[model samples]
Target: MLDRAGYDRYLAAFNARDYDGVADFYVDPPHMEFFGIVITSRQELKDFYAWLHDNVEENVRVLNFAASETCTAIDAIVRITAKKDLTRAALDAKGATGFFPITAGVVQEIRQFIFYTTRGGRIEKVECALPPMALETV
Candidate 1:
């Protein structure tokens, strides 16, 4: 089960971009699914988050969250700003920069739903659902 204090700690670690700290909340062989891509290991998740942090600065505002015995769901407004040049290929995968030019340093907002499953007080699975890229400003 996820308590408020535990969730707050996780949020703090994520907001701080502390990959290791965030990983500490997960159990071994943690699984994460984002945009249909599955990450099957804790180390891989940490690495992916590190890469994301390096490429973009992100801020998350939690609109609401609900917790059960084994699962927690969060609704959040996420803002991501490119810190450096994003490759054409990267933008293409996101289905952005095709119709509208999304150059580097552009800020985008996304409404996201994140679901977490916990076991023995450690997160065991995470699934993230996001809408299409809604460029707030480019």
Candidate 2:
């Protein structure tokens, strides 16, 4: 089970772009589902973030959080600064789920609900979703 302290550390690692530290919080075969795209292993998670980092800088700020023995749920604001233009067509072609129009040097913010299922203090699965009307200029 992941407690609040552990989850906080995970967020810190992520916000710092410590990819290996972030991966260490997950199980060996962790599952991640972002919208319709799915990542079923830790290596894929690392690769996905690496690719995403190349295109944009992302930071997540938690608005609310709750944790139980098995699950952790979070409401957060995700801020993304585009390092290079990411067009809708290009993202679609690459199956990059949960991404929107991003013009180089522009910033966008959106609200999301993220859930993680934990086992033995490591994340076993993660799922994320947007609230209706989630996108707004910051």
Error of 2 at 121 (Å): 1.2
TM-score of each: 0.83, 0.94
Per-residue lDDT over 1-138 for candidate 2, one digit per residue giving the tens place of the 0 to 100 score: 787789899989998878899999998988887855678887888888888888999999999999888899999999999999999887877677557878999988999999999888889999888889898866
Best candidate according to lDDT: 2
TM-score (C-alpha) between model 2 and the true structure: 0.94
Error of 2 at 98 (Å): 3.2
Cα displacement (angstroms), candidate 1, residue 95, comes to: 14
TM-score of 1: 0.83
lDDT string for model 1 (42-74, tens) is: 788787787667778888888888988899888
How high is the lDDT of residue 83 in model 2? Answer: 94
Weakest 10 consecutive residues of candidate 1 by summed lDDT: 94-103
Candidate 2's displacement at residue 2, Å, is 1.5
